[model samples]
Target: MKRIYTIALLLASLTRVVAQEAEQTVSSKINQVAVFLQGAQITRHASVPLKAGVSILTLTGIAPAVQQQSIQVDGPASVKILSVSFRINYMEEHKKPEKIKLLDAERKRLTTLITQEKSIQEVYLEEENILKTNKSIGGTEKGVEVAELKAAMDYFRQRLLDIKQQLMQSERTIRSYQEELAKVDAQLTELRAIKGQPSGEIVVKVSTKAATTAELDVNYLVNEARWFPSYDIRAKNVKAPVGITYKANVSQQSGEDWENVTLTISSANPSEQGVRPIIKPWIVGYNNALSRRTVSGSMMTVTAGNEVHGKVMDDEGQPIPGVNVVVKGTSVGTVTDVNGNYSVPLTSDAEAVVFSFIGYNAIEKRLDKGSEINVQLAPDVTALNEVVTVGYATSGDDDSDDKSRIYGSSAQKMKREITATEVIRQTNVEFKLDEPFSIKSDGAVRATDMVEYELPAIYEYYCVPKLEEDAFLTAKIMDWDQYNFLEGEASLFFEGKYIGKSILDTRNTADTLVVSLGRDSNVLVKREKKKEYSSRQFVGSNQKVALAYEISIRNKKGLPISIVVEDQIPISNDKEITVDKLEDSHGEYDHNTGTLTWKKEIASGKTELITLKYAVRYPKGNRMLLE
Candidate 1:
């Protein structure tokens, strides 16, 4: 019976030993990531040893914003991937098990020093009390010799001063320790908060028929990561091709530090809403009976918080970038990027949001729904005038403002559904970086290069003498649409020197794309009104003014350059006023815009002159201002 019991116990212990072991594997650090325009794809590798059975693997420390549905796994054919699962490690939410030992040690050291110094202070006070209790009196006190008393008195004074100095030094040291402690506490708080990146874990289930080592490839989607395109157009000379240094500004707040990883930036963002907007029926009516259905224009003040997300667009539904989005009566504001998309986070007291951009009229919209609130700002006539001057725009402060489209024509209104699979074909731009990159979780503008194209360009000199005497050098690039470009700030360089800046306008309707390469100091131009030939006369209650102007351009450089010198003739606004009898020497005039353009060539050290004469007639009873 005893031998049978012993055998049963041994068998039971052996059975328990078999159940104690489990199959679990740890994944390696992320080695590659594909970042899109708004999101990123993170990949991690893992090798698991299977023993002809099922096994489980967990990849820790992934981004919290990772989409579980996008997670994918790949491995050897023999290794069967059973299931892939994502979960947040809630254990970390309540407490962080790890700590910086060095910081904690230093804190303890400083605390000990403060406590010792305070204890020493109490001893000094006790010693001072003892000295006071020992002060001698006339009766029942041993009166020492005068020299001895004087010596004792001097010793007491010096000791007190020394003690006071020690206390002050200790207090100063305490303050210094406190400051350092505050900084240490801030770091500790940051560590405790676990901010700057969202951290989580990934788990994968696998099974195998035979024992083998399988390499597991895992990929997941994470948000708060993006890359945008920018360019640097540099031209060495008029004959050379414009050097376009295509750059990508990659920014991410995703939790993991992508250290020495393979990075690929795609023009794809699956987060973008691909749902086509449904247009409601528009009923246009001026009937008086419809007025009764109108709501009040006056809005009651909003005393609570409201957050809104929206796109700033034109009336034609084109995105308007760099619009200032501000909550009314608050200093908190932000400007839209090149995409013209803005997300406004409001305070509790925010009433409404105001959108303002150059060339567009200011708009104030009240937040009603939490969803997207698209606002279309109409083009202001005065603002349009400031941007479009002499057929060239330079005063537009908005980065998205099109130079050639100051008075933009309406675009076709069509709702189109765009999806992730079709995004690459739609965008037609994938910025292939030169090499591998490792970006920290910190939000920063990191640049990478794309391929450079040397397309053919024609250089021309342009001068608007009435506005400025300087002749700007422009390079007209053909087939500009071949390169997918977003309207952005361009730094222009010419002739081996950094000249200035120019805006790259892709929306301009022309056979060739024009880029201003800045001014040429060698080409001198001037416009002057001939005062001797200009006069004003009163004839039959009408005032007639005659004006003459001359413009000259000299080519001081060695190259013979063709210049387009531009000047304009004013037109009257009133029916009684007449502007006629014009004398143009060059005969290059646009009657519609009253603009005179001279496309002529001036040889080296040679000069060319253009003259214009016109008359303006207005009624004498009223005053008129003319340009």
Candidate 2:
């Protein structure tokens, strides 16, 4: 609803002869842009010349994605806005910037100068070549005196040198002109691309009692804008607090430039059709042949896909939660649950699936006629290296069997000029940008700096040589909720060195947030199998295997450190399989999961060794995954 204020003006009695009708086109400047997770609203200010009665003023250069009802027109009390309307002009041509004419003129001048420079250089080169080609000067001119022959030779040589110098100078000028022309060509190309897009207009009819200049603020909602949080977590050392560089990936394709406007990014989507959806009645009836044509609006339908289930693990074989698993060449994917397990449907044409996480290297694995794939992602050192790009991709209907060609993305990252402050809205969060920014009509993702924090934490070393050879360092932060972090990606830097990428999953987190700091080489860890005590034997109709392993850890650091050593034993699911006498030396054993954990504080320069032993008995002819 458009709100109009009816305030009386004391200076003038409202006298109307024939009502003065006028039409004025006003150009509005985008003063503020409120970007959300789903949509954006642009607030523009344009001052218009007003008569006493009614004037229909059109606000030009609007986006076609505007929701008509979301338009809000505000002005002073004396100016009563009568009606608001929107119209999309598809056939209307875009007006190129007047500066483009000046640019084109400069480009043409530079190009002409380059051509003239090249022509002069060519003539100089031709004359120099002709003079150099004549080597019969002495033989053809034998009648000439010796001093005159020497003078002729010197004169020819000087002319050739002079021509060469002229050519060199022309070549330099040509190169300069060519460089300037290239820049102008790029500018013209950009402008031309923008000149072909569609535009809309908003018309506002205002009735004022007297002639005055009226300031109008118009706001409208638009789609194709979003913002997500990204982080760069840096730890100078175990003793220093972690420094977090909070940033935002803001993106938009609002069909116009935002200009030097104050930008606000929000996690809330006001454009979303609110909750409390009406439940439609479910009718269950069998149709004879209609089942074959089940697609509602499509003429054809084909559903062919295979489900891929997998677990994502870290270097230590620890389940990594919140890892993204997507099919290659498709946006269809899902994230790993708290148990580090994901199940995504692979289209029949999909050859592989890519597993990605914040600090882990993304790996694409081929299906190879297998439904279960367990992957171990190595840590990528460039994980939190500072990304200035933003966008979102999500899985659509698996029943969509249309084998459309996957096109390459021409999308560019949107860049914001200033940082923002987070505001707590009624339903979601909003980040108000501190400085102004401008984004093009093309859908590009840009980044903006958000906030920074110094987090306090404790660091520890953890090792599980049974699964991985390396020892990993981890940081545990208390009261992580204070950061108000949403689920997103983060880059980790340990000891001022980039370790890898990791996820900031607050979904299933406990009171403390445990972040992996990547593998550590300074700590000493080793795992050894004792061949003397390990053997396989067949007793009666049963086969028996005995295994013994030793793990050693040393504290080589200057300060005492706490370490957690982990090992595991196999569990049997078959009735005939039996396991007995599993012993963990100086560690606690979990019966259900067959896990062993040893927590110890080792003094500087101290070494500790732990032993683990187990026996397995099964049928003679059977083989298990253990071997």
lDDT (Cα atoms) of all candidates against the true structure: 0.66, 0.70
Query: Candidate 2, clashing residue pairs?
Result: 358-501, 358-502, 359-501, 359-502, 384-491, 413-445, 414-445, 414-446, 415-446
The number of clashing residue pairs in model 2 is: 9
Count of clashing residue pairs in every prediction: 1, 9
Question: Highest lDDT among the candidates is held by which one?
Answer: 2
Identify the runs in model 2 with alpha carbons over 4 angstroms from their true place: 1-22, 91-195, 209-213, 270-273, 277-419, 442-445
Clashing pairs in 1: 197-255
Model 2: per-residue Cα lDDT over 1-627, one tens digit each: 123223333212343323455557898989998876556878999988787788889898887657677788999999998999988777764565565778989988997888888888888888888887875655554677789879988999899889978988888888888777766764553344345555788999888888899999999877545555667787777766666777776655556777888988766655444545587656555874533445435212212224678788878786666565765644345566656788765444556777765345779887664789999988767422122222222211121121221111121212222367777755666677777787765344466778777766566778888877677777666667756666555678976778877655554467867666788776789999988978889989999999989899888888777778998888888889888756678698888998899877788899988888889999988877652
Candidate 1, residue 378: the lDDT equals 88
lDDT of 1 by residue, 53-95 (tens): 6667777777665677778999999988888887766454322
